[model samples]
Target: MPDKYEAELPDEVHELLAAADKDREIRLTRAATAENLKFLELVRSKVKDVPLFWAVTLLSHPELGQAASSTSDKEVFKYLTDVELVQDAHDPREYEIVFHFKENPYFTNTELRKKYSLPNGTKPAPADGTITDEMRAFEAIDLEPSSMTIEWKADNDLIAKHPRKLNSEDDEIIDGDIGSFFHFFTEKSDIMSLGGTIIDVLAEPLEFFANDPSGFDSDFDEEDEEDEGSIDLGDDDDEDEPQRKKQKKERCCHP
Candidate 1:
């Protein structure tokens, strides 16, 4: 267990926690690795940035605007790739998000990707010789802001209004205190604090989920499966919530 929060977590978060715990063992078995890799390929092909963008959108709300600095993003990302957990002041939901992102693999620039080419293909070889199919490499995720561009879903229903009046004399001077969400993205684009934002906003929906998780158990499995890939929150489970919580074998990521 990676220290449960003092606050009760959402069921989906619980499901995620349970899975993360078992992943350490699952990664050691070659059979598990092959199955999980299939699932990962399925997800990487079908769900590219669903988690990343959804996480950011959840944070962009007035109450959940991210405060973590870019350095925090960098450090947290290091922890994420290493499958370790660290205390985060900016987001209480750090434990949950980090475990979820554990599958994000090591990626590189054009030069490095070129250096490790796989046999005849342009694709890079495994990150290192030790890299095996059992490794949880969610390499499809492009965390670098410069390498990725996002198209926000139309803002019609997505807008969040400010809860506090920016009445200070220099309120206009403060960048974050300004009036628009699009502007915030534009300003933060250069700094690469986008990762921090992804980490921070997770709390918003999670807090919402901690209460309901909007029925996440159906999509996630309690028993480690050979072909499981990733979290698909929309799916529904047959077991009632209380019973699902009792299972210890629940796995987190396919990898």
Candidate 2:
């Protein structure tokens, strides 16, 4: 919106617009989840190599691939069949990330999932409403932190296999090596902050795959010429009349 138009709109209207946008976002998240699930089915049936495709897709992306710090970490990724972010239909903030895995020597479990539920404040209501202060206070309390345990096979724990090699002088990990990617599951303090990184990749895997290792598209041509020519039709007095009528009708119908 233009600054002038924003200044003209009342605060109540802005609040209503924000609420509408949040509702629309929930709908969009559900739609995307359905489409992604459908694509997963297609991938299971049609894709010749599910494990390899997933491994490469993750390793290809520069940011996401950082999770796999070692060759062993990359090797474990080959067992992954599918990874997806499933958002709650009613609550957009509440979601889970699931990784479907084939039976492998690395882990006993087939699926590893991390669920999250960030609180959203209570809805505003009339003064006479039944909502109470105690209810609001209960809702405001911070929920328990989310965590996932990766059941690694004996002698196959990735985090243990690849310990952080520290610098001799400062006792800090050389080159900021955070050990194996499996540490993501072990993070107890700030899983939400760490989950954001994985969530980003799950949200749009295709976009990350398209950019690949260095966030560059080889097929793109930046030098392509754009047509600058424009044809101007002579002004007509009736041009604004139709738009005005449309606006008037919308206001009449909505109001």
Candidate with maximal lDDT: 2
For every model shown, what is its TM-score relative to the native structure?
0.22, 0.56
Q: Which residue window of length 10 is worst by lDDT in model 2? A: 246-255
| TM-score, cand. 1 | 0.22
**What lDDT is reached at residue 141 by model 2?**
20
lDDT of 2 by residue, 19-109 (tens): 6665554456546656655665564465444325555555554444554635567567767877766654333344566777899988887
Estimate, for each residue in 1-255, the C-alpha lDDT of model 1 and write its tens digit. Answer: 767657788999997776675444434443533443354345335534333322333322323222211222222222121111232222111121122333222222111000111123223324343433333332313222222222322432111322212436533434443233222322313232323433333323323222212222323332244333222222133221111112222212211
- Alpha carbon lDDT at 50, candidate 1: 35
- lDDT against the true structure, each candidate: 0.29, 0.51
Residue 230's lDDT in candidate 1: 22
Report each candidate's C-alpha RMSD, comma-separated, in the order given: 19.1, 18.2
Clashing pairs in 2: none
List runs of model 1 lying over 4 Å from the truth: 1-126, 129-144, 147-176, 187-194, 200-205, 211-255
